[model samples]
Structures are given as C-alpha cells and as structure tokens.
Target: MPLCLDPNGNRCSYWPQDAHFVWEKNGQKIETCVSEQTHVLADGRVHVLTWIKDAVVQDSQYCCLVSSKAGNKMSTSYISVEGSNNQDSWSRGFASWKSIISEHDKLMTNWKKTWESCNKKDIV
Candidate 1:
C-alpha cells in the first residue's frame, strides 16, 4: 500500500496546499521545481503538486513529507535512470543487503576470471 492515503483508503489524489509537501532526494531536502497556482478545490484545499525537472539524470531515492492540520505523512520512492545498468537494484541511498551481495559476487567473478587468465600456462 502507498504511504499516503485518503479517508476512503485510496492513494491521495490531490494534495492540498495547506498540507505542505516537502520533497527530498537521497535524504537531502530539495528546493527546486516548486511552482504554485491560484486554483483551489471545492473543499477549500488549494491543489499542490511538486515536480522535479530532468529527474532521470541519475538513480535516486526520493521522499515526500506532507504536513497538515490532521497529521503528517511521508512517502518514499526509489527512481532509477531509465538506462541504468543496475535498475533492478534499489537506489544507491536505499541499497539493500541483497544488492550489496550481488555486486560483491559480480566483482568476485570478474576478479576470478582475471586471475585465471593471468595464471594460465601454455602447454607444449
């Protein structure tokens, strides 16, 4: 299930300006890509959306914190570059032990191949 949900137990469709949405990338706060409008919802909640421009430059872990009079909610997402080699793995900041082990295994395999190639002896 998604971290943020509406009273009907559905993913939040429209975020309100009153519910300030703070965005972060790789655990650090991001200040850019903030745009606001004068539109307001029927419930008197101003619609708010946070967009990140050119976000696919690199793999990253992103988080959104929504604070309102009711309570505070947080949502996190791992975004990988479209053509990244390790797209199957989590973002660098949110790497799991599984990915680490996989990377270690790949390195070991490469090292073993190099060692075998270097130590090969020519037969008469």
Candidate 2:
C-alpha cells in the first residue's frame, strides 16, 4: 500500500523537507516494510509517497501521519480482502470496537511525537 501527501498549505511554494511522518498498522507502529519518496510537481506541490511493501493480505487498518510547521494531518485506511471467509468477516466486525479504541489511542500518541519532532528547532 502507498500513501501520498501534499505538504503545501496556503503557501503554494512551501517545501517542508523537514516534515515528520509515521506509519502504523492495527494501532502499532510499523517497524518494517516501509519506504518513502518525495516529488516536486510542476505546480509547486510537494508530493510525498510512502509505501508499505510485503504487507500480508488481511483485514487490517493502516494510518499515515505527517507533521511539519505547515501543519499536522492524519489519514486512515482499512484494507479488507475481497471474497474472504464470511464467518471471519462477521467475527471481525463484532469484535472490532476494542481494537478501534486501541488504535485511536496509539495513533494519538504517535502523532504527538511526530508533531513535537517536526516542530523542534535549534536552540541557537
């Protein structure tokens, strides 16, 4: 899976190379299968693409967070394999509330860290 971000806010030419990013799966930080790339479009938008390679095909949630002086933003995506076992799918929906809450808490904590790092400046 791949996530893309446009760091430009009201300022069209702003390029936030110091932006911070974190990727999570099922409320936990992803420690592997992650890579990132940045691109500058002709229209001056700074496009960032983060990819999660070799991910297992399953019903799971993923989140992407980016923080910079420009702003902080988070995006979530749920991946469900098509034609999965009906019983398994039903069970997942029935027991997903706790998982959702846990994920939310983890995301907030990680976002706070990313925000702090992205906003930190030299003490000079």
Candidate 3:
C-alpha cells in the first residue's frame, strides 16, 4: 500500500507478487490462493485467506482472513502483514508516509467494490 512520486524518476510502488495463502476453519486448513473458492467449515461457515506483498524488502508477507456463517448478517475479518528492515537506516526512493496514506484510500475503494460484489447476492 505504498506509493511514491519522484522528480528523479526513481519512484517505487508496492504490489503483491508470487503470493500464496491458506484458510483455516474448524481445525481444518485449505488453500485459497488464486482459486476464488471459499473454505467451508464444519459449522457451515465459509472462510477465505488472501495474501499480498508487504513491501520492497525481501521476505515480507501479508495475509487476511474473512469468515461468514449462513443466515448471519455479519462476518469477521482480520489482516496482518509482517516484514523486517533496519530501523536506523534510511532508504532513498522509498514512498513517503503521506503517499502511503493516499494509496491506502485508493486501495480501500477497490476493496469496497469487491466486497459489495461478493455480498451482493446474500440473503438478508
């Protein structure tokens, strides 16, 4: 969710690459990467996990989970991303915090559209 602008043409952006994720339900785990299929739990709940690239640094990962039950009007979701970098050092051409905030808004808009579409046919 980082964005950058540079006058020196060195701008860099964060994007998911070669991602994989798994979903857990009722003590069972299932793969859900690029398949678009939800994992069904023993209690008839649907769960999914998604992964995205965390940052430019190597060995970074981001994951999210969403769960829903039949006849339930609400669902639970969680997200987490992790990475390690030298805190004291500075990296040039990195996106500023402000740029990241702006990019987050844009990402949220896209996510909202996907969420609406996913729940569009659900029974209220």
Best by TM-score: 2
TM-score list, all predictions: 0.43, 0.52, 0.22
Give per-residue CA lDDT, model 3, range 40-73, as digits (tens).
4444333443443222343322333432232222
Looking at candidate 3, the ten consecutive residues that score lowest on lDDT are 11-20
lDDT of 1 by residue, 1-124 (tens): 1144455555454653256778788988888885433444554434555556545677889888878777898989998777677655556635677688899999999998887877785322
Clashes of each: 0, 0, 0
Clashing pairs in 3: none
Question: What is the lDDT, from 0 to 100, of the residue 92 in candidate 2?
Answer: 83
Pick the lDDT winner: 2
Model 1 spans with C-alpha error above 4 angstroms: 1-18, 43-46, 86-124
Supply candidate 3's per-residue lDDT for 36.
Answer: 42
Off by over 4 Å in 3: 1-95
Rank ordering of all candidates by TM-score, starting from the highest:
2, 1, 3
Q: What are the Cα lDDT values of the candidates?
A: 0.67, 0.74, 0.42
Better of 1 and 2 by TM-score: 2
Q: Which of candidates 2 and 3 reaches a greater TM-score? A: 2
The global Cα lDDT (0 to 1) of model 3 is: 0.42
The better-scoring model by TM-score among 1 and 3 is 1
The sequence of per-residue lDDT tens digits that candidate 2 reaches over residues 1-124 is: 2333444434444556557778898899986888887676767676777878655566788898988788889999988877554767778876897799899999999998887877785322
